[model samples]
Structures are given as C-alpha cells and as structure tokens.
Target: MSNPLSEAEDSPLFITSLAKGLALLAAFGAGRPSMNLVEMAEVTGLNKSTVQRSAYTLEALGYIAKEPQSKRYRLTPKSLEIGSGYLQTSELIERANPYLHELNRSTRESCNLLEPSGTDMTYVSRFASHKQISIHVPLGQRLPMYCTSAGRAYLSALSPEEAAAIIARSRLVAYTQNTETDPSRLAKIVRKAHGDGFACSNEEYYVGDIAVGAAIVNAEGRPLGAVNIAVPFSRWTLKDALADLAPQLVNTARSISNAARGLKPLVSPATG
Candidate 1:
C-alpha cells in the first residue's frame, strides 16, 4: 500500500516536525511506558537528534517527562487530557453509557464499547465485572478485527465486499493456538454474524477469554461501533453464551443504534 505520510511529506502544508513529534508520542504504548533517547529512536525509526528534539518539546508542553533517576521519557498525566477530551465530548459514548451499565448490572460480566479504527477496533468505554476474572481490559485497547468478536461484529454490519476487503488487509497472524488465520474461514464467520445479529470469539485473542458482540448501526445501517460482553472460559461455554447472552447483547446494541441515530454529527473531518 502507498504510504500516506510519505506522500504528504512534500506538501507545503504538511508539518514534518509536528508529525515527527506525534510519532514520538505514538511510540509509547502499553508495554512501553517509557523509553530513553536510544530506545525512542529505535521504536519510532527516528534519529537520536529527532527523538531528543521531540522529547524536549513534549516535555516542555507537559505531555511527557524525563525521569530523574532513569532518564527515560514517559508520558505525563496531562497527556490523558487528549483521550479524556474525546470521551467527554463523544455523544455516542454518552448515549450508550447508561445502556452499557444496564447490561453490566444484568449480566454481571465485562462489557465494552468499541469503535472501528482502520482494521482494528478500539475500546472507547469499558465496565469491569466485579466477579473474579483472568483478563483485564482497559480503555483504549485496540484489537485486530478478524480475531475479535467486536471487530467481526462491526465488519459483519458492512457489505460482504467491504468486510472481505478489510479481512484481506489484516495480517491474520495467529495470536493463540485457537486463532483462525484463514481469510476464507474468517469471511464465513463474519457471514454467520450477519445472519445471527452477533459475533463471537473463542479464545482467539487471549487464552480463557470468550466474547460475544453485536454492532451498533446508524439509521442508515452503517455500523458505528460494537458492544461486547466478555466472559472467562472457566465460567462460561460458547453454547451457554450464545443461548443466554446473545439476545441481550443484540437487543442492547439495537437500542444503542436507535439512540445514536438521533445524535448530532460530530464537528470533525472524516479520517478517510
């Protein structure tokens, strides 16, 4: 595929320096909470000088800080404002929160609201089950579309051709022994989700984690996101989940979709 950033590099309006600074920030993630200049350079594919400059700028802006002892740069609490701003202003999330809470209360299981971002689904909101569990999913987690129930549910709401194209673009790497990497088989699962009104994953992403999801659509039938309910494998079987929880999940998703249709359009440019 063509590199969009590379293509934009020559444009007069494109700010290479700003992009580099953002890339430096993006390099810090779940397992990588902090990094030294050399590590930043390696992760961001930037030179030491560029990493130093970006880190300096971020530190000055209070987005990141250099540790006194380790000299490793880490994001500051202020950096959370960026994500917090989104959560605060998201009409969809606000509308879905009450229903998500209701689902959580009724099922006493982990529930999440995930939105599509490219070939992956991103968690925008999450409610943890108080019950003992093996997995802990935090907000802002991103998982592959093909192997995740939420992702497949979102894809299932799309046209077959569109869903197939997205699956084609995915890496399809096996995340676990049970992860299905075959594109054709993945397509079949998506089709089943379309017919069934919900999709499920059987320990594809994480061991002992089973999840079912249904897509939230706009009035026009475009999928905006997905609502997911995840349970531990030791406590629930796929048959039990399908028989007991799928109806609730699908109904909750449908209710959210109906509510979302009445929301005003967000004042942001479309990413694509």
Candidate 2:
C-alpha cells in the first residue's frame, strides 16, 4: 500500500508544519493525557526539534499547556473547540442526534453513531441508557473494523472489493477469544450484513458487550456512517437482541438514511 504521509510530502499544497502541530495535539488522549518532549516525539514519530517547535506553537495558541513542575504538555479545554466546531456544523450529526436518543430510550441501552476513520470506526456521538451499565464508550473511542458490529455494517454498504481492501490493511489482532481475525470470514459477515441490513458482534471487540448495527446511507446507497445499540451480556442474549432490537435498529438507520438522501455524500470514494 502507498504511504499517505509520503504522498502528502509530495503535494505542493500540503503544509508540513501544520500537520506536525495537529499530530502533536492528537497524541494526547485518554491513555496518555500528558507527555514530555521525548514522549511526544515517540508517539507522533516526529523528531525532538520538530516536537519542541510544535509544542511551543500549540502552547502559544492555547491549544496545549505545559506543566511547570513536570515539564509535560497537556491539552487545554480550548483544544476541544476543534472537535466541537465539527459537531456544531455537521448536518449528519444534527439529523442523527434525535433518532439515536430515541433508540436509546426505546431500547434502554447505550447507542452510538460511528464513522469510518482509517481502518477503525470512531464514535462521533453517544447516548447512554438510564440503567446502570458497566461499559462506558466515550465519544472518539476507536475500534477495529474487523471485529466491530458498526464497522461491519459500514463496510457492508461499500463494494465487496473495497471492504476487502480495508480488511487487508487492518491489523487483525484478537481482542477477545471470540474475536474473528480471519479476513475471509469477516468478508462473509459483511456480506451477510448487507443482505440483512444489520450486523452483530458477539463479544468480539469487548468482553461482556454485544452490539447490533445498521448502516446509514445516502440516496445512492453508499454508507455515511452507522447506528449501533450496545448492551451488556447480563441484560440481553444474542437471540433476544436479534429478535427485539435488530428491527428497531434497522428502522432507525433507515429513517436517518432517508433524511440524509438530500444531503451531500459524506463518504469518500475508495482510494484503491
């Protein structure tokens, strides 16, 4: 596969410094909230000098702040303005918000809206159930396409070849004993999802969690993203989820897709 970084390096319009600064900002997350210059360089694959320059720029701009005691950099609340800007302006998210909340209310389970980001599905929006649940999937959490129901649902809307290419690029590591890493098997599951209009994961990505997902597509039948309802195993069985929640999940997805028909397509064409 061709390297996107190398391709960007060749582009005349690509801004290397801007990319470095953004990459540095992205390096801070739930796991690594703060980092020294060396840690930032390692996480972002940039040299120490570039990391230093990017950190300084970001600090000056109020996106990140350095701790005087430890000399580690952390993202400020101002950094959220970047993602907040997208949420404030996104039509798709706006349209899906009410529907996802309704699904959460009806199912009494956690619901999420996820979009394809590289080879993973990123949670763009979430609605938690009123009932107590052990798992908490925060917005922006990413899960591999091969083992996630939402990922399979999104992939099912693409051409078989396109979906296969993405699977080929994914690192098929088993997150649990039930995680299926076989490319061929995953392709078959995606095909089934396309036929059924919904996909399911049986504790594949996370233990004790089961989910059902359906793709939200444009008028052209291309996926813009997916809607998922996740439940803990203690509350619902696979058979119960399929019988009760699957229909509602598919219906909600269809309603969103219908609303999205008049909008511009959000999904990019297959690069390969």
Candidate 3:
C-alpha cells in the first residue's frame, strides 16, 4: 500500500486510519452537528465511499453513532472519552496539575496549560482555581494566539519577522480595551516577551481578566508551549500582581522547562 501522508511533507500525520477517523469527527460542526455520509464527504473533502467506510468504523468503535431516523452521524460520548484519555496522559497536565492547585490556594486564581496549534492556542489542560472569576470553556477551547499571554509567549519564540507576519495574518480585533490591535505594537510586545522570558496581558484578551505566561523550552531550546496563571480583576491590582507574582510565574516556567530538558521530575516516580 502507498503512503498517503508522505505525499504531503507538511502533514507528517501519516496514519491513514487515524487521520480518516479524526476527519470524520471534525466533519460535524456548530450549525451541522449531525452529518450524512454525503455531507461528511463534502466537509472532510474525502470520497463518499471513504466517508461511508470510515463512518462505519467509527460507529463500531463507539466514537460516533448513527441517527436511525435522520440517517445522519453524530459523535458519541465515547469520542469525548478518547480525547479525555489523551488529556490525562499529556505531559502538560501531568506536570501542571499540582502547580495549578498550589497557585489557586496561594493566589486564588485559575491556571491553564496552553498548546500552540498553528496560529491558534488551545487550553489543552486547565484547573478551576477560583470560583469568583471562573471562565466558561471546555478542555479543548481554542482562541486567537495574537491576543493572549500564553499565545504571546509561544509567538515570542519566533523571529521578529516571522512573528510580525503571523500577527499581520491574525485577526487583531479589540477583544478587550487593552487588547493590542496595532501589528507593530503587538510585534514589539512579543519581542519584549522573548527578552524578558515572560509575557504579560492586562485585560487584553478578556476584560477584567489578567494573565501572565512564560515560554517552555525543551533540550534544544525549542518552545514546547506556555504555562499561564490567570487572576481576576477583583483579586489583585496589576501593579501588585506583577510585582508579587511575576517571580513565581518565571520560576514555575523555568522548573517546567528544566523538567522537559531531562531535569528532575516534579513528581517523584513510584518505587517498587
């Protein structure tokens, strides 16, 4: 059998079955949560016969269910279970879970682990630390990278030219009063974040929500993602938070980075 993935170097995601299975699930969207075989083929850009076979495979695996009346396909709760299993084993969640609770206990603010997905960022893992200023979103919530502290830190790893190009292509709307809309201004911020080893946002992405994040670098100094601490406006002033908490944020980032670089793990391994 010929390799479909090697045909496109951009997509190293080689496994045909896995790709088709995920594509089938992604075919269902907001307005069209349920899709027929033809609609799935249209959405996925796959052949109708391919969609039919994959849909059958997905249904057998309990990842999707066939709507008997509508003759449409919709994701099953089991699909979400598969995603949850990935989240459970993810290095981000494994390392950040305890720290999130600790930050919550000390500062009473929520914490999140963000992973860069192209020009977007996703909260792959998060812990609800504060009851008062909690934001509503699921585990896989994706948002614009240009407007967020976590996203900014990831962007910081890029060259100024590459960074500017990304920002230019992004939707720089005023998500909040402090959101940086100007491309030049945002580029400067990303550069500074690279230099400072941290990124800061004061009610920029979301109103009354301030966030701070630092880049996580691996052994080759390549950025892995970003770890962030979010505090509600009612919790602390920007001046006070930056002064008191910045050191902790930077230290935590360093710890995570070092761990990823084969340093001592945060959690001790089980002994036989």
Candidate 4:
C-alpha cells in the first residue's frame, strides 16, 4: 500500500514544517511525558536544532510548557484541547457514552470504547468500575492489536482477507506469557471471534486483565470501533465472564453500532 502522508508531501499542498511541528508534539506520549531537547531529537529522529526550534514554537503557542527547575518540556493543558476537540465533535463517542455508562453500571467492570489505530487499539472513552479491584486503563492508552479483545473484535468484523492482511502487518510481539505471537494461531483466534460474534482475551495483553469485546459496525457492516468489558483475574474467571457478561457486551455493541449508523460519517475510519 502507498503511504498517504508521503503522497500528500509530494504534492504542492503539503506543508513540511507544519508536519514536523505536529510530529514533535506527537512524540510526547504516556511513556515519555516530559522531554528535553536531546530526548526530543532521539524520539522524533530530528536534529537537535530542529527539535529545539519546534519545542520553542510549541512553547510560544502555549501547547507545551518548560519546567522551571528541570527545563524539560511537557505538554500543557492547552495540548489537551486537541484530543478534547475530537472527543467533543465525535458522533461515535457521543452516541456510545450512555451505553458505555450503562454497561459499566450493570457489569461492575471497566467498560471501554476503543478504535483501531495502525497495529494497535486506542482507548477513546472509558467508564470506570466503582469496585476497589479493577484495572485502570486511561483514555488514549494503546494496546497491541493481536493480543487485545477490542482489536480482535474489530478484526472479526472485517472480511477474512482484510483481517489477514492486518494480522500480517502487525508486529505480534509477545506482551505476556499468554500472548499469541504466531500469525497463524492469531488468525485462528480471529476466525473464532468472527464465528462467536465476540472476541475475548485472557491475560494476553496484560497479565491479570481479562476482557471480552464486540465490534461496533456501521450500516455497511464495517467496524467503526469496539466496546469491551475488562475484568481482573482476581475478580472473575474467563468462563464466568463469558457466561455472565458476554451477552450484555454483545447487546451493548449492537446498540452502539445501530446508533452510530444514524450519525454522520466519522473523520476517519478505524484502521488496523
């Protein structure tokens, strides 16, 4: 497949400087929250001078802030506006919020709305469980596609060829002892998810996190996102979760998908 960004860059309409500035901003994530000039250069693969210039520009724009004591640059509250802008405008998020809350309330587990991004799934919205023993996955966290129930649920909604292509492209690195890294085995899992109408992962992505998910499909049957319920190993077994929560999870995903079909097209389709 051709690179869309490369194609745009080759055209006269593309702005290289703007892209560089955005790349610098994206370099700061959950793992690397604060960074200095050297760290920014390494992460973005840009020269120190270029990183310095971008950092300065971001600071001036109030998107990033420099620590008074350490001089390390971190994203400011202003930077959150970018993601908040999307959430505020997203029809899918808007439509899914009520259902997500309901699912969380009924299941007493962390319920999440995830969208596929590259070879990972990004958590867009979550309703936390009130229970003391629960996994806390913050919004914007990314997990591997191959080992996550949400990712597999999205894959199960796609055509076999499309699903296989995505699996072929994934890194498939082992995140835990239970993570299935083999492409063939993972493909079989996806196939089963397609047959079962839902996907599940038992300590595949995280050691103690067990989750079940179903894809939210559009009118044309393409997946727009996924809804998942995550339970800790200490609280529930996989068999119990499937028996008790799977039906509700499937129902929630269907409701979200139906609501999503009535809304306008999303800014971008969920990708794998």
Index of the highest-lDDT prediction: 2
Which wins on lDDT, candidate 2 or candidate 3? 2
lDDT of 2 by residue, 83-127 (tens): 888778888899999999899888888989998888888899999
Can you tell me which runs of candidate 2 are displaced by over 4 Å? Answer: 1-5, 269-272
For candidate 4, the TM-score is 0.95
lDDT (tens digit, per residue) of candidate 3 on 79-182: 88867887877776687667655765666667777777656777877766656655665677777778888889878976676677667667778987788888
Two-way lDDT contest, 1 vs 2, winner:
2
- Among residues 3 or more apart in sequence or in different chains, the pairs in candidate 3 whose N, CA or C atoms overlap within 3 Å are none
- Cα lDDT of model 4 by residue, 1-272, tens digit: 76666678899988887888999999998789899999999999999998889889999999999999999999999998888887787789999999999999998888999987887788999988779754667788888777899999988988888788788778878888999989889889999999999999999988898899999998888888899999889988999999998999999999999889865334233232
- Backbone collisions counted per model: 0, 0, 0, 0
Q: In candidate 3, which residue ranges exceed 4 Å CA deviation? A: 1-18, 27-53, 67-72, 168-178, 234-237, 263-272
Q: Using Cα atoms with residue i matched to residue i, what is each candidate's TM-score against the true structure?
A: 0.93, 0.96, 0.75, 0.95
**Candidate 4 wrong stretches, greater than 4 Å:** 263-272
**Residue 216 lDDT, candidate 1, scale 0-100:** 90
Q: Choose 2 or 4, whichever is better by TM-score.
A: 2
Candidate 1 residues 85-126, lDDT tens each?
Answer: 988989899999999999999999999999887788889999
Clashing pairs in 4: none
In candidate 1, clashing pairs total: 0
Sort order, lDDT high to low: 2, 1, 4, 3
Candidate 1: where are CA atoms >4 Å away? Answer: 1-10, 262-272
- TM-score of the candidate numbered 1? 0.93
Tell me the lDDT of candidate 3.
Answer: 0.75
